[model samples]
Target: MPSIRLLVLACVIPLALGFKELKHVSYTQLPTSISSAGAELFQGIEKGTADAAAYDWVNHVLYVVGRTSHLMHVIDLTDPANPVRLFIHQFTRGEGFPNDIDICGGEIAVALSANREVNEGHVRFYHTYTRGSGATDVVLDGYVTVGPYPKSIRYTDDCQSVIVANEGIPGKDEFNTFVNPEGSVTIIHNERTGNPAVQTVDFRKYNTDDAAAWPYRVPSKYIPIRPTVAEGTEPEDVVVSSDGRTAWVTLLENDAIAEISITAQGLGLVNNAVRLPRKDWASKKVDTSDQDGGTHRRMYAGLKSLRQPGKIARLRIDNKDFLITADQGGVTSFTNAKHGFTWTDATTGKSLAANIDNPELKANANDVGYLGRLQVSSLEGKLFDGKNAELVMFGGRGISIWDSKNFVSPMFDSEGSIEEYTDSFFHDIFNCDYIASTATTKSPDTNKDTTSYRQGDFVSGLDVADDNGTVYMVVGMYGTGSLILYEVDTSAKVPIPMFQNIVRTGGVEDTWSTLYTNKKLGDLHISDLGIITSDQSPVDRPLLWVVGAGSGSVSIYNITESLPVIPGR
Candidate 1:
């Protein structure tokens, strides 16, 4: 509704107000001052950077999660002039690797990557604290294990419960090949000082292998034969409403999203004894027989199951009135009051026809869409845009958005086309182990055969600045030992990253990652490695902070002040 003004500053204010008075400075690349210092931080990381976490509760102590160290490296930012490593703690799990993470009320939860070799997955919780020596660290709190592998942990507003998306297998070897029951999602209720309350939710009632063929012809092998509920479904991401009363979990293995009721569980210190499910819970499962042949995991014959990039994603509320789902092919919006859930063309922005009894989301071929065009408005934030709610998602490949708004006939009808919409653009990429707003590393072409869909490095973690709606996405590119910064403006028409910075030690060409490169430019992607900053701030102007993960240092730059720092300066 309002226009964003980009302000640039000339003189640096006193160190105290420097972060506050700095104005937004636009640029194609990151500032040299910040980039140079960033690269130096990763000198000792052998395996490479895995994730990053920032503590704004106090000053700005940032924690870099790494695969090489297999530990969290803490950097103190009280001075902003110098960021020093405060602490490092290492730990390993059997089945899952550490991926995304979330921190609230002093507790931290990280998405555990599944190790197919072990067949177990889970999310680890910790009780974090600051030591008297000014070193910040975390003490491992009890963790909760779940189906196969949990890919992400999305926390409710109150941080009382966490919704985890279980991907079922470690992406390294087994990927989509494992034939277990569709992986299920779980809500872990965190008690203030005790272990978490875990609820295993199985919405895998529908299987893909039971579909019938037509026209006297056999079903094509290429068609996705849905796996059976007995085989498990994959749920990727869990999103919560602002009120923290509901959670929408996305099932990636099956094309569906589950609305779970959190209000029934209540907020604050949670009571662990509640079962919370009603009788209709059995009906929540959808039939995926058409997608998967009559037999689950049988279509692959002797080979392992390959993953098909499905066209379904959602942003909705649990046990609430609305849900918005977008498939790579189309978008679907459903209202709790009537019409069940309806499908739509994300590109064309029109509602499609659906038969709820035998629900097959039929979108006109002409209307098929991608993740870039869809968004959802909901009552799920500390701040609301009047009737225009939080646009829960900035479009991405195979991602979902969960908004708590009441569903109208056609989803987002009153919001107008996304092109005309004015909100800060948000760009999020999930790679490495964490989910970062920016893509950090470039995957090797040799590895493309196995990780074809993954063009870049992995994301280690992410966090949103509740005060200003700025999303801090951390991508840990293990291959190149770099961290990339991508910013999403909540008020932009489309997500456009204003800047990108690379974080690594020394020149990327001299790094060990370069020694293993098969082709040239493999290490060039991270030539400018380091920490990152964004312009979206509830504060007068926000200074994006970047701390080097490997070198154990920090870099701070006011996004507003560096716009005119001049190229090559």
Candidate 2:
């Protein structure tokens, strides 16, 4: 065991200076056979390897699922310093790819998407504990068919039910026409029983005239050319309440959160979809261009961003429920250039600059030194009044904390702080591409460039860990391959997120090939994060497990705390 460091000034410090250190313990690279099978399918695309991870505290095991590999690699975590691979469970060819996983009450449930995105997917169940040394030790329990593209899954706190979020992304058919399935939520009751009752709740009820009057940005109303009312609203992730009576689903594209009522009668009712507030870049500074000289951040006059949260987690503070979201923005880019019905919700700042009438905003958008390469949404702030037009971007570019009671706006947002920290600390690789760019690559200073810093620290994964009431947040950046730790103070009226530390996990080396060849300690493109506390860990220390999709590796870290005090105090 490593020596534990204690903080001398525990109470006198301002708490903002109090930091948590993440010590890299060990890492294991998944077999190439598991990650290389479907490599040819997504040639130029940055595909995920170890997508999601679920820890079984009872067995001291970690189960990691590969998104494109179609396999689950199980590892024994009895020794935190040295992890051992136990076995691998391979899903059949047509069974589908595992998207997300969760463990509860000696049972493991995996959300799987079909071979085709438009087809119906399923939730497969298995035993978490291995009876023997073979792969068959993990017995197959059963499976329940779910909606299209089941993106995320979670087991209720009670372990009696399982909730799944069906994304229902649109896909082209044999005739090349788009087939959009209605997004839905699947709830499984008596999951441990032989015959489980399944209830798939859809958003069909909200497709009416009454729902049309809602305040949120409905995709159908904004685009009007693609999916209908129900089909346009896709559920990205689902988190359940402590009592298991309510579930909040993140509608990423719709810029809203759907509250669902879970009942004993096997019915999940869609109570309401509450729209989230947008972030005004005019007040919050953002790095709008990769062509700008070395992470240049400024407040744009007309730039606003939607908080299109990709993943969500619930945290309880002072007996009140707060929802934390990783606002990873997304855009719909389906186009048929031949049919002339080509419509995309996102466009470059240069394109919007050509259409808008604002002279100052137009000049900024036209100049590569400004916002020409930035990607903004075309759905909102398009005022054709010749005087003003607000440029609405796609994502919030940071994490947001929202009051669960009131979903109207966020209690606190790490606006520009994440970018500021990354730029100051990681200037050499600031805003570098996770897949394409190397660690030696630097953001262009003066010349007009687009690829290097186009996508700033794509905040993709986040998890909240509590160490004896001291709350900490671990934010995973997909673009730069970094992890940021923050000490969250929620006792006051509004929670204050204090910066602790930032560690670069993936981009320590020059290239992915060299990093992989050398068996690098950190991997790229962090897709998901899981935390095992001291009480839950077999090694009796808190462990942070990071799943890197770009490099096909799982990096483990041992967490410890330190308190820095003011000189007088």
lDDT of 2 by residue, 406-505 (tens): 9766777777777766766666666665435532343222121223224467688889877676777888887667787767665664456666767775
Candidate 1 wrongly placed segments (more than 4 Å): 1-48, 52-56, 92-96, 113-118, 131-137, 170-181, 193-195, 208-226, 229-232, 250-258, 266-541, 545-557, 561-569
TM-score, predicted candidate 1 vs. hidden true structure:
0.48
**Residue-pair clashes, model 1:** 70
Best candidate according to TM-score:
2
Candidate lDDT (C-alpha), each: 0.35, 0.75
Candidate 2 wrongly placed segments (more than 4 Å): 1-18, 34-47, 131-137, 174-177, 208-215, 220-225, 335-342, 384-388, 435-455, 507-509, 562-569
**Candidate 1 — worst ten consecutive residues by lDDT sum?**
297-306
Q: How well does candidate 2 score on lDDT at residue 34?
A: 42
> Alpha-carbon error at 15 in model 1, in Å?
29
